[model samples]
Target chain A: MRRYVFFILMIALGIVIGIFYAQEINPVEIVDAPPNTLRADYQADYILMVAEIYALDRDPAQAARQIALLGSDPPADIVNRAIVFALEQGYAPNDLILLRDLSEIMRTWNPNLQLEPGGGN
Target chain B: MSLPLRPWYLLTGLLIGVVLGVLYAWVITPNEVLETSPAMLRSDFKSDYRALIALAYQSSADLGRAEARLALLEDEDPARALAVQAQLTLGEEGGTRIAQALGQLAAAIQAHREAPDDPIIASLQAGVQSPSQATSTATVPPPVVRTATADPAGQPTATTTPSGDAENGGNPTPTITPTGLPTATATPGAPFVLLDIVLECNPNIDPPRIQVYVTDAAGSPVPGVAAVVSWDGNSNRFVTGLKPAFGLGYADFDMDPALSYSLRLEGGGEPVDNITGRVCEDAPEPYWGSWRFNFVQP
Candidate 1:
């Protein structure tokens, strides 16, 4: 029984060392992350820009394509999330209006036409 | 059943444990990568980011904010990035406005970076609300306009007209005061009147611009004045001094040689109509070039 106990102790030590090495020494670093990897705030700002351009050009197809680049969130949902985030963050009234307008448009856009966001996030 | 204690058993257990640990650490759970930067974006997505910044700058007209946002891209030179992208994609469908915005922002940033000491640029960096803020985001109403008092017709010219010293050739002087606060010499409460029109013949100007320079009676370039360009029932409004590199008192509109445009400044003046780029015979090859229009408040 003492011999078995010693073996288990050694195994536990080895496992601890291996975990430490894998996690701290040579962990994977995602330097080339996709747009979907952006934080919630940046995602909101990027979505706002799309709304501004959409307000000008009124190109739903291109607008949908641009928003879809961020991730697979349905265009309307993505915009709606941004609107909520914008409101929470106290975005200017004009900017909030633009975001809401975009959300409305995205709601009607055909999701079947949405393009897949490229690459792993 | 009791077995003899064996070193092999200990080694086998240790090896198995290590393998499992490594697998679990690497695959089962890892540090979540949060707050990924714009700099880390994929190459194509980086282009999209640039477009977003450019478009935002077009509406916001905030030079300082544009620079700060662009810095996140980790570009060695943000202006060069904008210029190169504008050039590469200018010909694509639906790319005209994006290319123009990128090009304009690129020109503004490049000018700002190059002339850090200019007072006008200094004031611009300090940033008060710009004239663009007065106009609506989606559609800009064209400002009122009138003809030059000196030239009744106000037809754009390849050479300087007889308004004032056109000695600077077709080019508007880039910066007036090397050091000092931004000049307030521009006549307050007055509208910019068409003063001169000169066509520039430069090999570099491919999509020639309708370059505008607004100055006061003192010939000091003015910033923050509004101008409008209309062609084929479509109108666009932009404020001068936005691109300080061109000149603190300068602003320009991209002109398609195929289309003629009408220009109007904010105060009452005869609108400068029939504005279009003409061929520059003096160039090494015949090239359609930019038209330069000078406006001054009375």
Candidate 2:
């Protein structure tokens, strides 16, 4: 009986040691990104890409689906914010013109939605 | 009941098994185990992300920020990476919005390198220098300036007529005659010759479109000319129209991709024959399939 108990404990100890040693060999690292830290520039790019997609498909609902990826804000609100951001950032006039045209189309598509005045000062 | 049990043997066996298992898990298996992270994107998504960064760079004109974002893609050459990805996507799925955006982004990058002083580039650079000044000063005048410079000898005539017509907001019939006559007279006795032909195939658009431009030997755009495109075994006849945006020389035609095309100048010039359209990329659907024909009367 004594021999059996000693053998069982030794085996258990070996298994535990093996697992502990393995972890030391390869440690898992965890990184935490801050919450609500979406970069505004990235968001702006996302909005522009969505706008381009809208231009291709001409489907407001489909565009709205893409805009939803940014946040809960409506597509029009996101577009308005993007336009303001692009203007403030001094995006090329041609690109700004396209964005303005997109905003107009979006407004016409969704009458209830309010958009910021385009071509900012 | 068989042989006497030996505890030492059992203990040794367990120890051996544990040691072997640990060695396999930590040493041999480590290499075999594929490490994946939620943060890591697949190759396709990574390419799409790079293209979006490129487009954003176009708008923002922030190279430092663009490079930083591109670095995260872990690609040594982000532009080439994008091209390869775009090619693959086009081959697999014909012309898609993603594929189109990728191609345009690549073209834009190339264009920026070629023409750093271009209005878009200048504005972008200015935006980097002083945002407020960029917005105020870098409005859309460069193209207008280019148009003005193209007619340096006719500056007096070019400036007076166009500006007058522009202000009146009336049909510029008077201005057209003056500009057209000078272009013809400027180049004395230059034969109208076929300059070059290009085909652009875009699967994204149905019924491919062709753009034709006519220019003088001096490369001045010649307006109010007709370009004809036809293919063998097809009764359809195609003609080019003046596309002001592309210049006075520009004309366009929507063509059937299945048939080959031949281009000839309506009034004179040799015919450009045996023009065939193919899938621009290996994508399952044909996108951006196009051809360009240039006619020059030198």
Best candidate, TM-score: 1
Docking class of 2: incorrect
lDDT of each: 0.65, 0.48
Which structure among the candidates has the greatest lDDT?
A: 1
Of the true interface contacts, what fraction does each candidate have? Answer: 0.54, 0.13
Alpha-carbon shift of residue B219 in model 1 (angstroms)? 9.4
Scored against the true structure, residue A97 in model 2 reaches a CA lDDT of 64
lDDT of 2 by residue, B1-298 (tens): 4236675567785796568557756767545543422124555445545655544444333333344455455576554565555545544544344443444344333322333334444335323422111121112211111111121222222211111111223434323211221122114445467655555544555566666655555444454354667777553322221223343345566777677777776656677776665567647754656676666765
- Which stretches in model 1 have alpha-carbon errors above 4 Å? A1-11, A110-121, B1-22, B30-35, B91-94, B114-298
Task: Single out the weakest 10-residue window by summed lDDT for candidate 1 chain B.
Answer: B144-153
B-chain TM-scores per prediction: 0.44, 0.37
RMSD of each: 15.7, 17.7
